[model samples]
Target: MDPSEVEFLGEKQLVSIVPNFSFGIIHLISGSVGPFRAGLPVKVPIWLAISLKQQQKCRIIAQEWMDIEKLNDSIEAEKRSKLFTKMPSNHFMDEAQMLLMVAPDDIPDADNIRTAVKDIWDLRMSKLRSSVIGFVKNAGTYAKLDHLTAMEINSIRSLLPDALDIMLHMEHGGKPTVLQSLNTTM
Candidate 1:
């Protein structure tokens, strides 16, 4: 019979006799060799065999994939976060570090991460100072008296001027906000 004249029957016709024969072929060949280039009669079959072999190799390699390195990197990141305080490392250094970590590819982006860190640090410091001041203010009449002896009153009054200077500096240093008003208008 001529090759072109041969017809492969569909699988459904043989369901009762050989249910698993869902595929059919006229001629099948397999081999481990070949350039099987165009203009060669055997090229098509050879190329199909090579493709099947490569696909099987890929499946085997994929099965051995591991995530150990990713796990280790995640653990290291957690440790670093714990060791470092979230406060900005002074203003300029903080900005430099944030820019390095989050380099802009395009667009005029503000360093939001740095801004957030500074804001949180400022809030925490404000709360702490307020608490300290409140405690000292409520301690007693002795807390306000200048009769506490020369050395003690000098130490207390010295802290007062520095605290006042910081409050004044913060008031004029940035965008106007309600918090700044609380500190400055007092």
Candidate 2:
């Protein structure tokens, strides 16, 4: 899947916002938003929160897991763990990117949080690459991807399948068998 597609999924995650204006609950296909009152926090999808933030109608309350201290700890844990560690959110990277981009002013220590998140991502990606290499070398049919986040999995979506197909072809002595079809019948 494309990064944009992953981001679209991430946009569905709920976030807190303190709207400056009052409004009744806005119904959406996903669910009802809220009867937003001035200066009161309400949970809404990231997409709507971003929209409201862009329009200067509300201040986005950063996700609880977005705290700099928490992020730093997560980075340390990821560095120490050999296997993929559980992330605060399934779409943590995308959510952080969107929230930081839209409302950096509202989130405390935005720069530090960004750096910490990047560190964690880099560490995880490095580990994932090493694991993939080992898996391919061992000719393993299955892998346990317990704690890998959506973005991480999507990153390898294209490469892994193609690599496996190549391995299969090699195993079959590179013959064009029934599994391999020609472009078109002449």
Candidate 3:
């Protein structure tokens, strides 16, 4: 999914790149970037790296944690944990997809990244499904879900309203649920 603008822009990453040409330092609100040199590595923001890569000015080194090995470890750790574990980044898959699209050759094991990402996504989805099932089984009107990403909330948005409507219908005698209302033919 294309993440919200705020999430995408707010993601700060250290991207290593080898510049094709030399240039003076570039200043940003975050910090001063680099006085670039040909064939020398420099760390720049992911946004700036994407821009420079698009312009054919640099070869981006993928984040260390973006590798297949690291991702496998992360997924395993998450699966072993009872609670929702922190992912490498909240919108990592989105960011990785974008960067790989622009500079596939520059990233190490670009081909495997997709497969690794998919595996991690599937595992997380399974966990999420279990959580939703648990939530439904619990006899409670309200519950707080902290530490979930915005994308996670959006995924369950449609289900929440219907579930709430059904809860209300169960509490109040003979009131139509949202599903019942939607099922009516005009």
| Model 3 TM-score, all chains together | 0.74
- What TM-score does each of the candidates earn? 0.21, 0.95, 0.74
Per-residue lDDT over 30-104 for candidate 2, one digit per residue giving the tens place of the 0 to 100 score: 899999999999999999999999999999999999888888888888888888889989999999999999999
**In TM-score terms, which candidate is top?**
2
- Model 2 is weakest, by summed lDDT over 10 consecutive residues, at 177-186
Residues 66-132 of candidate 3: C-alpha lDDT, one tens digit per residue: 7888988877887798776676766666667767877899888988887887777777777777887
| Candidate 1 global TM-score | 0.21
lDDT of each: 0.32, 0.92, 0.76
In candidate 2, stretches whose alpha carbon ends up further than 4 angstroms from where it belongs are 177-180
**RMSD of every prediction:** 29.7, 1.5, 4.6
Comparing candidate 1 with candidate 3, which one achieves the higher TM-score? 3
Clashes in candidate 2: how many?
A: 0
Candidate 3: C-alpha lDDT: 0.76
Top-down lDDT ranking:
2, 3, 1
Q: Rank candidates, TM-score, best first.
A: 2, 3, 1
Considering summed lDDT, which 10 consecutive residues are worst modelled in model 3? Answer: 1-10
Note the clash tally of each candidate.
0, 0, 0
